[model samples]
Target: MTEPLIERCGLRYLHVVGRNFLVWRKLMYASMLGNMADPMIYLVGLGFGLGGFMPAIEGMRYINFLAGGMLCYSAMNSATFEALYSAFSRLKIQRTWEGIMHAPMTAADVVLGEWIWAALKATLSGAAMLIAMYLLGLVHGLRPLAVMPVVLLIGLAFSGLGLIMTALAKSYEFFIFYFTLVITPMMFLSGVFYPRSALPPVVQAIGAVLPLTHGADLARGLTLGTPMAHPLLDVLVLAGYATCGVSVSVLLIRRRLLK
Candidate 1:
């Protein structure tokens, strides 16, 4: 009974993913263009423009230092955008989730499927950025390839976080508050553009708790071939956020849909 039930759930979610992929295929060009453009601009603009005047950071060129962070940021941005805007549109505007619920699937399955879809999209975006970095010679050696799993982990963490916001959102406008208050701060404070050590002690402490910080640390360590201060702790932190966020998202969306 239990095994069959699990298989059924997996198949249902895979169906959802397949449906989304088909829809995305129609707009693949635009989606890929936008995803590639944004990160490339950031990499060139901040990395070269700003990094030109900056001294070597952590014993590496500024662009080299920024590359790994960009990889993590790409994953984070992709996951969050898919979870917030795309998920909200499906759940509220397009009524896609409503249509899916009419099938044999539960609200839990819908949310899980959406989360998985978002994570996959994030991974693709991150992979694109990683390839660009590699072509530019910012990443070297086989160790950089190890960052792929970390990118997926970052995706999972942010996707779940995005869905939580989606559940609380009453309208599209609600996301402005989340983006401004939460995501923006995390981008700046989470060691993406600079080292966490440069921040004040209190802010550093706060950054330490953010999922992106751990993700950045992991990505940087792998890409630069530097040893992590505490790699095990970083993995644990990201995994904790992903697990909690998904659980909370399921519970929240269940209440919202059932009510």
Candidate 2:
């Protein structure tokens, strides 16, 4: 009989995190720059280019509004990329997970550790975006610092989701479907580029169910100092996703590896 997921996991996962951290440290500057650069380009190019023409969004500058979207988007992209490509490399290309499992760990521990490592990386990207926005005067006040926690949650939520996709993926080619069908649509429809209301009602219904929508809503409200109708609901939805991702991915990965 297989071991329970809970029983198979322990503090040893931290060692996995530490291992990834040490590897990351060697190229920290390059990795950090990669995380920050792409989003900064979006913030600067679009904020200055397109935002210059548009009027304030709900009394906030267009760039300020864009900054909020970029914040969550940065976390989402960073976590997804790390969970998918980097994690896949470790799992498939490098066979890192197999080697790790030889130690006193299980598949669940590997999944948990990889998910966490990806989340932490994504959080760093979000922090970079937050600080950049602060320097650019896009976010203000002590309250905006609270966005970091939300950013971390966004990281966990998306990275977990990414792992689910990773578990199902047969090859790196499989990822194109996820990015094209899921990530790209969520990026546009989650109010990252504009208000959710701007989308059609049918589309709004679709976006409402996605994790990114809740995440962007939280990011926008907190960063732009605006009120949200259901902040608690948004947080719950993301937490639910993170939970589901961990649960489902563990089961699937166990099947993939052990069965």
Candidate 3:
């Protein structure tokens, strides 16, 4: 029988994480190169090309404003890509999860490991954007250091949500609907390219409930050295998403991978 829920995600999950890391290390350079490309383009292309036309937002340059949202966006995309594509390969295409299962572990162990690994890897994406912002002179002082924790939290939030999607996907093509329907809309609504304040009231209401909204607000606040309206509440919302997403995904994946 499978272990109890709490017992399932024990310290042994780290073993799965270590195994994935070894596999990933071989492709680390190529992986980082690919991951850095899009965000860098957005940072430079949009930040300068478009930002020049936009006026100061809430007293900060448009580029500075966009950088914060980009940080959260980068983290979110990184975690989602890892959790969905990489985890699915291990789950279905390669049968890596099966091998790990025979390593004397529960499905929850594998799920949690992937969850944490996605989050960990996502921080690299977030860090890349942050460093770019620094080099471009968009961030200043010690404030950017505060953005790392927010990046990790964004990673955890998206990773959990992505795993939930992965658990239910029947084929690789199934992921297209999610990216197009969910991530794309979220990117627009969560204020990545512009402030949500400029959106219609109805759209604003919907965006407020998304995890990226809170994450963007937190990251933006930290990057710009501004006060977060409700730091505790925003964090609680993100943590809630991560908690529920992982819990539900564990249940779903366990049922999906029958022994």
Candidate 4:
């Protein structure tokens, strides 16, 4: 009985691990090299290059201020790439989940495992960026180090959201709608390049609703030695986003598959 229960619990998640490893295996050194390059370019080009004209922000050098925001941005990008692009393709084209479900695995188990896997990858990417930030001396002392785990939580929050979007997506084209209307606006308005306080009251209120805004706020506060507007509130909001998104994805995938 113990062995059976253990297998039942472990089989689905193990498959998810194996599948993700397989996917990672197909990514060549060139692809990894490109991902490594994109962030550095953003850091140098926008941070160092454009930062000169951008003015000093919040008592820190503009480039340094932007690095925290860029870290948040990078984490979001890594999560969405796996959850939206790859997850949707696997579900629609590869039918990978279908094959897994035919065995002892349930949809819930597979999705939970897959989302965790995506979050793991996102966290790894974020950690890599954090190391780069440390090397630059942008992160001082143990506070930023303490915040590293929270930064990963932020990544998981976005990964969960991206998974839900993948479930809702009717086609890959639908992703553009989200990217354009929601993400693009948030990317610009979120205190990435500038403080949200500079926005009009109404726009500030709107920015408050976006996940990236809170993530960036928390990150910038920690990294730049700025006081948090409301640290607990930001954590709660991020947690809420993760919970709702994961719940929705689980429900949708269950309806589509196990039902």
Candidate 5:
């Protein structure tokens, strides 16, 4: 393909997002009942419930901390779920990826389109959750607005990784290992409910390796109105993750589909 056409292929990824709009809209409505409920329970349970005992983080309310972490969680959940479940389904059962490749699009285009869509969906879902948190007064200043781009970067990074995982995944059951071993651990150890400094030295080192740790730190700093430190490092690491993820995902799709 020509350079312009290849670039356009990336743009078609937006159509991939548009195509799924209705289905996600319906799903989001259904998810809202559950998504909204879980955050509310957490905000209440920890913010006011356990918050009575635990002091605020950095002098900010506990709920605010909880809200920021949860917002990041929501975006991560959305991106990872879509990339893993839906992408796997299309690649395996539905053969949607294969079908797309038969069109003017190549395997690279198919993977790129799907990953981009997943990122967009994840961003929308996460943003909705953030707005809900804001309405509840759990969110802090407009600094939290910085979260939008961060959410996009995190989602894009995870979407590529999710694609790579889906490509390698043999069954839905395989996801169990990923969520249990990797995702769950990162969720807790990434300084969600507490500070990373609270952990032991070795564990803190492990936390630093996880992208969620940096993502959470960035989100928390913005939401709580704290000064950003080494902001470029955070961006660079997340960008590195995205680059590796996209490279692997493209390679996998080409190997799987074009072969």
Candidate 6:
């Protein structure tokens, strides 16, 4: 009975994924372009433009330093966009969630499936950035490939949080507040553009609590072959965020859908 139940659940989740995959395939080129463009621009524009005027950081060229951060950031941004904008569209605008719930699947299955799909999409963005960095000579050693799992963790972490926001969102405009107040600040404070150590003590303390900070640290450490001060702690923090975010998102989305 348990095995059959588990298989049923798996099939339900895969059904959701298959639907999303079909939609994604139809717009594959645009999706690829959207995912690859921003990170490449940041890497080339800021890495070269600002790097030319700055000295090497932490014993590597500025572009190299930026590359690792961009990997983590790309995953985060992709997950967040999918969870917030795309998920919200399906849930509210397109009425996709309503249609799905009319099937055997529950709201929990829908939310969980969406979370998994967003994470997978985000991983693609991160992988593209990583490969671009490699081709441009910003990445070194086979160790950098290890950053892929960490990128997925980053995606899961952010996607969960984005789902929470989506649950609370009534209109598309609601996301603007989340982006302005949360995402934008996190982008700057989470050591994407620079080291957290360089920030003031108070800001560093805040950064220490942010999921993106842990992700950026892990990605940078893995990609650059630097020793992480507390690798275990970083993983635990991201895991904690992913776990809690998924739980809360399920509850909130369930409540909203039932209403």
* CA lDDT scores, all candidates in order: 0.90, 0.90, 0.90, 0.78, 0.77, 0.89
* Span of ten consecutive residues with least summed lDDT in model 5: 1-10
Tens-digit lDDT string for candidate 4 (1-259) = 1112123445567678677877787984654565456776788788878888877788889888888888787777777778888888878888988888787777777777778777776666667667778888888677786567666777778878888888888889989987898777988888887788899999999998888888888888887788888889988988888888787888887777654
Q: Write down the TM-score of every candidate.
A: 0.95, 0.97, 0.97, 0.89, 0.90, 0.95
Superposed model 4: Cα runs more than 4 Å off: 1-11, 26-28
**lDDT computed for candidate 1:** 0.90
Ranking by TM-score: 2, 3, 1, 6, 5, 4
Question: TM-score winner among the candidates?
Answer: 2
Off by over 4 Å in 3: 1-3
Query: How many clashes would you count in candidate 6?
Result: 0
Per-prediction tally of clashes = 0, 0, 0, 0, 0, 0
Query: Per-residue lDDT for 1-259 in model 5, tens only?
Result: 2222244424655555665676668777776565456655776687778777877787777777777787777777888888899889888988877777676666667777778877776677668767877888766577678788888888888888888888888889988888998888988888888877889999999998787777777877776676767777887887788789888988876777655
Worst 10-residue stretch by lDDT in candidate 6?
1-10
Off by over 4 Å in 2: none
Better of 2 and 6 by TM-score: 2
RMSD to the hidden true structure, all candidates: 2.6, 1.1, 1.3, 3.6, 2.8, 2.9
CA shift of 149, model 1, Å: 0.9
Model 1 alpha-carbon miss at residue 90, Å: 0.4
- Better candidate by lDDT, 4 or 6: 6
Candidate closer to the true structure by TM-score (higher is better), 1 or 4: 1
Q: Compute the lDDT for candidate 3.
A: 0.90
Residue 87, candidate 3: Cα error in Å is 0.5
Indicate the worst ten consecutive residues by lDDT in candidate 4.
1-10
How well does candidate 1 match the true structure in TM-score terms?
Answer: 0.95
lDDT of 3 by residue, 120-150 (tens): 9999999998889889998888867897987
> Model 5 off-target regions past 4 Å?
1-10, 26-28, 32-36
Error at 244, model 1, angstroms? 0.6
